[model samples]
Target: MSIPSFLKLVEIQTKVASVIPFLLGTAYTLYRFNSFDLKNFILMFISLIAFDMAVTATNNFYDYKNAKKTYGYNYEIHNVIVRSNLKEKTVLGVIFTLVLVAVICGFILFLNTNVFVLILGGISFVVGLTYSAGPIPISRTPLGETFSGIFMGFVIVFISVYIHIYDENIVKLIYNNGILDISIDIIEIIYIFLISLPAVNGIANIMLANNICDIEDDIENRRYTLPIHIGKENALKLFKVLYYAIYIDLIILVIIKILPIYSLFVLLTIMPVINNIQEFNKKQTKKDTFVLAVKNFVIINIVHVISLGIGAFS
Candidate 1:
């Protein structure tokens, strides 16, 4: 396959969904812990981006394989496999190669970090694999948004921060005489959760937007996504709610001093994001309005990460 076909197969443009959150977590770690580990940072970046690519490739591969309609929008234009006339074995080769790279990098990260890295990395690996490849793929179910948001949003952020502060006693495991004990600092975990909300909301809205646009197509394909289950009206409402919820979470974070007062400047970008949301509310089409969700995500999180940087640096 050519480079363009391969990039399309992996949906490389969508990798920003993961990349932004990774930056958010890194910024938060710097702000909260006042420490940085370049080694682990590099490892996490390679692992996270590789896994994200692998998961996207896997999803596309499965989607093409299982699609019911063979001559329409999805088959002809949307799916790269069908569009590019790529061989199945070649696609599988690309997917497996990406996954192998991700796992190796993640394992190296775990060896340098702690048992929590191993445990959480394992969970993320399972979730990413099962998200689009299993008999009952998560993307085909109503839980797609929730799972994607929590894992890509909260879990990635938490793991990013944790790797930097693994020796901080926030969460620890002790094993002796075949018995194990675990400890956690609830306050710190709560802070991390609050800080993760913007990314969570943004990522969830992206998935919701995609589902909303693809509802008819998805239903015809026997993929009962969230929008199909809840109806588009309610799904749009949920999308609006999730976007607005980011500001509320930001307010709480600022009030608690989890984020610097400078971070409140992110509120200035809200109008543009709201505008995008209204446009999306007006029309929900994959080629037309789906990008509004991505625009909103970028509007919110870019300012968010910049605010974090200002807070950390000053």
Candidate 2:
């Protein structure tokens, strides 16, 4: 597999969906907890990128095997496998190798932290695999946005933050006499969730945009996603509404003072984000406007990350 084909197969362009939130968690950890675990962060980033690549690779492999010859499925712009004619064996080998590396890194994180890390990592691992493989892939259902938003967006941030603070007792697990008890810091979890909404909505919007643009093709392909079930018009409406929610979450964080006032600078991206949404609304074509979703994700999250980083310094 060539470098370009490997990048396309892994959807390297979309990795920002994960990268931004991870940085947000890091920034917040710095701001709130005055903590940074470089070793854990490096391990997690390696594991994360590896696992993310594996997920996309497996998904592409799945589509390459099952996709019908529609809008360039087999010829021009279909799965990278067809576009690049990468060997099937090589794809599978790469997927397993990435997954193995990710698992090893995750296990080391567990050793460094606690078993709770393993639990969280395990859930993400299961979801990633179920996303495109097995019967009833999550991507084929209307719940794709929920899974992608929460896990990729929220959960990644949650784990990233927790990795730095595990010793601070966000999770209390006790085992005695074959019985176990657990206590969680609800307030912290809620705070993290609010901080995470910007990324959650941003990432969710990416999938929403894709589903909206592909609604007709999705129907023919039997994907039955949110855009298909609710109809493209409604899906697009949801798409616009979700972008606004990203800012709302940011403003709310400021109001609650969970995030510093400096973070409100991220709100300035609203107009451009809205403009992108409008253009997408005007034309939801994959080739013509799909890049808008990518633009929105990067712009919104990048501004958010920078603002939070500024707050960290402030």
Candidate 3:
């Protein structure tokens, strides 16, 4: 495929979803733990991009494969495979190659770290593949937002931090006589997961917004996503609520002493966030205004990252 087609097929622009949290998590590792594993961080970033590309390609490939012309998902505007004249085998090959490379990178990092990394990475792999490749793909369910949010948001952030501290005493893994014993720092993991909810909510809103805009087309294609089961009005209400919850969770993070107080300054982005939300509230069309959600995602997460940076330096 050509450059533009490949980019669109992979939805390269949305890498911000993964990239932002990777940065935020690395920042947290640097500031709070006073640790930075540049080698693992680099490997993790590469693995992340490769896997993200695989996920996007898998989503687009399946959507194209299952698309119904009766619902107007024709080649002219939908399905990069048809629009770019790429063979089905060619797309599948690319997906396989991307996944293979991602797996290799993950394996190297696991070897450099510990079995804990391997187990956690294995969970991410299962969830990532099931997300789009399963007979009943996660995207077709009401739980798409929750799944996408937790995996892409919290899980990645958790993995990023875990890799930097893989040798820490928080988690223990023992292998004897072919039996594996595993232990984890439950409270620490829970703490990060809770603070990570802001990004989780933001990432989920992106999927939620996309589902809301594509509700009719999705139903015509027999994919009953969140908006379809909940109705557009309720979905929109949930959209607004998720964005607002970011601030609520940020406040909780600070009050709990997990996040530095300076990170509370992220609340300053609320005005623009609400403005974008209102614009999306006015129109939910994919062609016209679905980008409001994407824009909101960038604004909220970037501001949060900056807040963390300030705290890191202070």
Candidate 4:
């Protein structure tokens, strides 16, 4: 592929969306331990990139096929389908094969047949494929948002942490280091909670927004997404609940000292979240607001990683 074609095929925006979570997990792992095996880190990074690309390709292929069956080869769906000229079956098969190979290589090079690593990797692979391609794609169900959040939030975070910190030596280090003993436990729990909060909220909000935009289309397609199931006003209320709950959770974590007081620096992310909420409240189109929500989520994750690094290492 030509440079421009290759870039378009991979879809830089989609790649960034995939990379943000991995980056957050990596940064958190490095912060907690203050060190990483460079070779393993590089391998994991490559595997993540490959995983993202394969999933993107697979989702686009499946969505395109579904859209074509319903909409009759419309250009609107064509534009959204990556590598649109390729046959859907061929694209799906190729991407799935590539992802399986990548996972195998990842396990061999970085994970060494560890059970936790295998389980996490298997879950990720299954979720990524079944998300859009299964007989009952999770994206089409009422539980779509919940699944997205958990996969992106706790599962990904836990996998990244496990890969980086689960070696015998690291376990021994954490056990022996008196200062880290209490802090590590607290941080791990808090991190899991906080990470899930934004992930769940952000993903739910995104799906809600998309459903709102495509309500007519989605209904016609027989997809019962959250917005369609809950209605618009109720969905907005759900968004508010999700939004406020995240902040409330953060505050509680801070009070309990599960999260470092310094990690309050993540409060800076609240500004964008507030702005997005206000826009949503004003009944603004969610398409206009989606970028803001994503920005806020990314900033919060970055700030959390930074604060954890500073508090743990300093």
The backbone clash count of each candidate, in order, is 0, 0, 0, 0
Model 1, range 185-223, lDDT digits (tens) per residue? Answer: 999998888888888989999999999999888988999
**In model 3, which regions exceed 4 Å deviation?**
70-75, 177-180
Which candidate, 3 or 4, has the higher lDDT? 3
Ordering by TM-score: 1, 2, 3, 4
Model 1 segments beyond 4 Å from truth? none
Best by TM-score: 1
- Predicted structure 3: lDDT: 0.86
- Residue clash pairs of candidate 1: none
Which 10-residue window in model 1 sums to the lowest lDDT? 67-76
Task: State the lDDT of candidate 2 residue by residue for 1-314, as single tens digits.
Answer: 88999999899987888888889899889888989999999989999999999999999898777666445533258578887879999999999999999999999999999989999999999999999999999998999999999998899999999999999988878889999999999999999999998889888888888888777777777788998888888898898888888888888889989998988888788889889988988998778898898898888888777888888887
Among residues 3 or more apart in sequence or in different chains, the pairs in candidate 3 whose N, CA or C atoms overlap within 3 Å are: none
Q: Ten consecutive residues with minimal summed lDDT in candidate 2?
A: 67-76
| Tens digit per residue, CA lDDT, model 4, 213-261 | 5566667677778888888788777876776777777677678765667
- Summarize candidate 3's per-residue lDDT along 1-314 as a digit string, tens digits: 78898888888998999998898788777767878888999999999999999999998888888777433543357668877878898899889999999999999999989878888889988888888878999999998999999998998888888888888856788999999888878988887787677779989999999999898788778888989998999999999999888898889889988888988778888999999999998988877778888888888888777877777788
Q: TM-score each candidate.
A: 0.98, 0.97, 0.95, 0.80
Better of 1 and 4 by TM-score: 1
lDDT of 3 at 48: 95
